[model samples]
Target: MDAESQRVLEYLTEVEEGAEDVLATKQQIVDLDTKRNQNREALNALKTEMSDSGHPELRGYNLSPLSTEEIKAMNSILKR
Candidate 1:
């Protein structure tokens, strides 16, 4: 084969490799964007539901209604 043809084939191979890399990067970006949107929608829905549930009027910690003394006792054990 001619030298010019060999150079052209090498250039084309390089171009193809670059294109494949760009496509893979684009796919990864698209996947990440999709996941972020889904997570945002889920968080917004949860916030709306919590608001509708009147969480503000519940009048206690969401975790437990335990007294401060009980919490201190648990913390002491956890420190060990």
Candidate 2:
């Protein structure tokens, strides 16, 4: 093959490498956005829990839940 053909092959290789890099960066951005949205949802849930003073009691047997002290500490953190 001619030198011109070799140069065209090299240029195509370079472009392919760049396209791969762009795809990887785009994937990272998508992952980060998903994480951010999930965190936002969690924060909203926390806010709702904090604002709602009355938590319904759970009945029906031997369910060992958080101690009253632990519950208080969690509530305090939510307050801040």
Candidate 3:
């Protein structure tokens, strides 16, 4: 092939690879966002259940009706 044709082919190849990378990155971001939302819902449900049940631990700690941020912080701390 001519030099110009070869260069064009190479550029097109690079563009295709970059597009694939962007698509994969976007998919990862979407998946993480979905997971985060699910986790938040689960946390909220658990908090409601805990408060409704009047769990002894929460009563002892005076942590009834936990706020989302407080639960998130506690979850992070417990994970560590």
Candidate 4:
């Protein structure tokens, strides 16, 4: 085969690989989003349960109606 033809084939192969990589990354992003939603649902359920449990200690600590964002902020502060 001529050098130019080989170069074209190599370029096309690279393009295909790049497309495959993009597809894989997109799938990974979708999977992560699904996992995040599931985690959020579970966390929300736990918060409701904590509130319904009527635990005096939880009320005292004000953790029964916990907000996910608040927890994230607390973690950020602690990290600092």
Candidate 5:
């Protein structure tokens, strides 16, 4: 191939690689968005459950402090 043709091919190759990178990044963004939505739904469900259960420690605006057992339970859940 001629010099100009070879240069063009190299430029095209670079463009293709850049496009692939962009696609991979887009996929990652989509996956993260899906995960974020699922986490939000789970959090909302937990909140609803807490409210419905009417546990004194988790009730109204004037909330009391958590007990030692509650703290341990929360810690265990967070570690997971």
Candidate 6:
């Protein structure tokens, strides 16, 4: 009702809005970072599976399932 009270209320509104914006930005950054880490882990797993050299007969069928040609191609990429 009073001018002083009105100014205080206006200032509080501005502060709350700014804080909400900062929190939203931080949440977005955290989400993006989590997604990036997950993708990096998935990529590393795929690379490991592709390059594992244990023969299927020796290691059983549960090992990396790449064929001889695929393994050769992966080796070429590593050499490069």
**TM-scores for the candidates:** 0.67, 0.64, 0.67, 0.65, 0.68, 0.63
Select the stronger candidate by TM-score from 4 and 6: 4
- Those runs of model 6 whose alpha carbons end farther than 4 Å from true positions after fitting are 53-80
Total clashing pairs in model 2: 0
lDDT, model 3? 0.94
Q: Which residue window of length 10 is worst by lDDT in model 2?
A: 53-62
Candidate 1 lDDT tens digits, 8-61 = 999999999999999999999999999999999999999999888885765675
Name the TM-score of candidate 1: 0.67
lDDT of 4 at 37: 100
Ordered list by TM-score, greatest first: 5, 1, 3, 4, 2, 6
Q: In model 5, which regions exceed 4 Å deviation?
A: 56-80
The residue-by-residue lDDT of candidate 6 on 1-80, one tens digit each, is 99999999999999999999999999999999999999999999988987795555667556668999999999999999
User: What TM value does model 4 have?
Assistant: 0.65
**Over the stretch 1-80, how does candidate 3's per-residue lDDT look in tens digits?**
99999999999999999999999999999999999999999999999997788856645664469899999999999999
Answer with 1 or 6, whichever has the higher lDDT: 1
Residue-wise lDDT of candidate 2 within 1-80, one digit each (tens)?
A: 99999999999999999999999999999999999999999999999987785544643466789999999999999999
Name the top TM-score candidate.
5
Error of 1 at 20 (Å): 0.7
In the range 21-71, model 4's lDDT, one tens digit per residue, is 999999999999999999999999999998788767645654466599999
RMSD of 1: 9.2
Residue pairs of candidate 6 with colliding backbone atoms: none
What's the residue-level lDDT of 54 in candidate 6? 50
Clash pairs of candidate 4? none
